[model samples]
Target: MMVQCVICDILEELDNTAPEAKRLRNRPIHTYMCAACHERVTARTNERIATGKFRFYRSSRRIEGDFYS
Candidate 1:
């Protein structure tokens, strides 16, 4: 049996102006199913999450003083 892998994107909203839109615009959120396909969508989603590519950050703190001080 031959198995084929599919790629997809999961987003909250579909906005062309959105920053995420650019990256996932051309990608498919769902994968195609065919004979002998054992790949799970959940697995793929987990991989993406672990990569930090979909992380949300508000702000970062900085050290104003000198390191030696």
Candidate 2:
């Protein structure tokens, strides 16, 4: 299957039976990022994390028992 990287907009080919190809075929919301762009992003993110000011926030899941009397 052929897919385009969302970041660089470069086209690349993937084997039709690959798990990633299957994901792109099955989900329209999922995005494709080429290896080069993925590595660039990872490196930049690691730099930010190393600065000690980067905060990674995640939603806290509430338990049902917490709300019960």
Question: Quick one: best TM-score, which candidate?
Answer: 2
Model 2 off-target regions past 4 Å? 59-69
lDDT of 2: 0.84
Write one digit per residue (lDDT tens) for candidate 2, span 1-69: 889999999999999999999999999999999999999999998788679786556533353234222
Instruction: Return the TM-score for candidate 1, rounded to 2 decimals.
Output: 0.24
The worst-scoring run of ten residues by lDDT in candidate 1 lies at 60-69
Local distance difference test, each candidate: 0.43, 0.84
Give the Cα RMSD of candidate 1: 14.0
- Alpha-carbon lDDT of model 1: 0.43
For candidate 1, the per-residue lDDT at 5 reads 37
> Could you estimate the TM-score for every candidate?
0.24, 0.82
